[model samples]
Target: MKILLIKAARLKSSASRRHDGVMPPLGFLYLSAALKKAGYTDITLLHLALEGMGREGLERELERLKPDVVGISAMTSEAVSMHMAAACAKNGRNPLVVAGGAHPTAYVSDCLEDPNIDAVVRNEGEITFPELLAAYGRKAGFEGIKGVSYRSGGRRTDNPPREFIEDLDTLPLPDWDLAEMGRYKDFVPHSPMLYGRRYMSVFTSRGCPYRCTYCHSIFGKRFRAHSPERVLRELRILKEKYGVSNVEISDDVFNLDRARAAAVMNGVISGGLNLNIFFGNGLRAELLDEELIELFSRAGVKYVCAAIETASLRLREKIKKNADLEKLRAAVKLLVRRRIFVNGFVMMGFPDETVKEMLVTARYLWSLPIHSFLLFFCRGYAGAEMCGTLPPARRIDPKTDNTCFVPGGGCSSQPAWKLLAVKQLTTAVFYFLNPARIFRIFRDLPFRDARLFWFLFRTMSVKFFSPARR
Candidate 1:
């Protein structure tokens, strides 16, 4: 069967579009590999953002390709766009539309509620998707396929949940050939501390054991990782074949298994593959130690983003973050001393959190020797612990809601506007106090690329000076 998979873009505004760059949809790449293994060779992968395609462009592609099935992967922020793509597919060629990824996995019924979407694949799609296709090929009922939700006789029928893949090493390598690697190279996602011209993202592991309130455990809390040998092989391919000099390790927790993590890093060094690495995904601060930091530096890790959600111990515990402030501070200091760039991921405007609490966390971050701070207003995503507990109206679209400019409606004790003001003030004060960070950023760029400089400047301007206050 001819199949088309689309990775939808979430940006609505022109400004947001400029800031957002397309990262390869690793999920779809794996799915493509799975399909190819299942004997479905006629598969096409389309990344709308990377291709600069809109709904009309997507419709045209659907009409031209005339595929039997179209699968769309999206995050919660891309809900509207997901529906639009599904609608376009349905109207153009009447293909069997399937929706997957974090958003659909969390809201299965909500996604299937759309008439255009024929089914929703939950969680891991590698095994379930192939089975789904087999069922469709045989013209068999989908009741037997696990981990899929579909419409049956005008009623939604959800099959039993599928188990998470225990042996991540067993999965086939992602079908990178199907992706537009050249276009991806031209318009690469911006990484704060990445050094190389050619870069790509790699996931060495799956799942996180931590129970952060704002996080969804779609992969469950059990951590399963690819063996170090398998990881090294992939790295070698990216280096030798793709000319990828820099890699963003996108593991939820890269350092979860200290020994395994160390082994992987050491293997990179031993192999003489001197690739610049950055952990754009936030790493757990409490897990870092001097030994690990040294290993990271030796492994050519240029920068690390640590999840310092909130500095207030009370708030941290309340949110079930369970992070040690002292350990986080030490980690930041050690990374800085080792000449590694440190970026702190800070969140503000919790349900009952006060402006004082938010500022306290902000002040704590500013006091640290970190190179940059990523300030985000707390968003209660679907399937997260906070989503169930928060009032329905309080739940804001994570894509459009700038808690820094508009109040996150979830807070009852604080007005949304006040929360916005605090967020803006905290950002202004932190950057204004540390002008050296600006200089350090310029010094860290591998080459004097105008695009990179413009990205940095635009990002900072939007964060500190955007007139989107509501």
Candidate 2:
């Protein structure tokens, strides 16, 4: 069967990009490889971001490909746009549209109610989609399909639980050939330093075993990994086959299991894959130690980022982020001593959190011996422990709560706007106040790149100065 997988762009206009036009969506590549492995090579992966494609572009592609099935991977942020695309597809060709990601998995009911979305693939789409195709083609019951929810007789039916992939290594390497990789070279992970040229992402493991209220509520608290050997095999391919010099291990929390993490590092070193590994996904601060830091350094791990979500122990507990402040400091010290780059992730605006807690968090984050840090405003996703527990009056409007709402489930409410503003400003306050931080960022470059430097400086300055404070 011909399958068309689309990776929807998160931005409505071209303003969201980082100087560069747009980058290929990685989600589509993963699904394409999975679909290809299932004997569906007649797959076309359309990246809306690179093409600057919108609903009109989606309709045009459907007309061109006439794909038998349409698959969409959307983050909560892009739900509204995804819905528009799905509606266009349905109107243009009526291809079966399926969405799977954190958004859909968490808000299955919200997704099911959407008339345009035929089915929502929950959890891991790597395994779920193939099963869905097989079941559909056989003209048998697709009801038992694991990790999938469908609408039948105007009602949403939750399927039996589909187990997580036990062996991540067995999966096919992502089909990077599907997207224009060179366009993403300059895109860095919101870091102040570093040449944005040369960027890529790879997942060394799946699942995070943390009860960090926000994380568990989004990605589930189970930590699973592809065997080290398997992980290294892909790393080799990334370097040799795909020419990816920089790779982000996009796990929720890599190194949750030290042995597995060490195994991965050992495998990469043993395989002699010459590449820079980035922990773009946050790692647990409590888990880092000298041995692991040294091992990661030896293994060519260039930059590491860990979560220091809150300085307030109370807020940390409320988020279930069982981190140790002392250990976190030691961990940062080790990385700094080794000259390895480090970044910390902090959050603010918890239910009972105060500005003092936020200030303390900032103080603690700055105290850490690290190259850079990111402070984010806490957003309560729908169906998360925090969201589910919110009082009816306090409940976020489903339309605006893009953080956890299923792709295409439109609930345009004021709360989402507030949440978005919170996220933007929290980041602004952390970095804008620290002039030394920005200078540290500028010091890395020579005077010759003044144009690019100023471009970024002005861009960031505008954001820092004019924060979306309500």
Number of the top-ranking candidate, with TM-score as the measure: 1
User: What TM-score would every model get versus the actual structure?
Assistant: 0.94, 0.86
What are the Cα lDDT values of the candidates?
0.80, 0.67
Q: Which candidate gets the maximum lDDT versus the true structure?
A: 1
User: Residues 376-426, candidate 1, lDDT per residue (tens digit)?
Assistant: 777777788887888877675644532332344443357756766776787
CA error at residue 161 for candidate 2, angstroms: 1.9
Give the clashing pairs for model 1.
407-416
- Candidate 1 residue spans exceeding 4 A from truth: 14-16, 185-190, 193-196, 397-413, 445-448, 468-470
- lDDT (0-100) at residue 129 of candidate 1? 95
* Model 2 C-alpha lDDT per residue in residues 1-470, reported as the tens digit of each score: 88888776564432345533344565667778988888888888776766767776677778888888888776666666667767877884667788887667776776677898889898778788988888877866678788889987887788886877777777788888887777665553433333455556777766766666654334455776777777777778767877887777777767888998888887777778866776765577578888998888888776777778788988877778788889888887887666666777766656666556667776677666565555555555665677665556544443544332111112212333444444445446556767766654454331226545765666555434333322
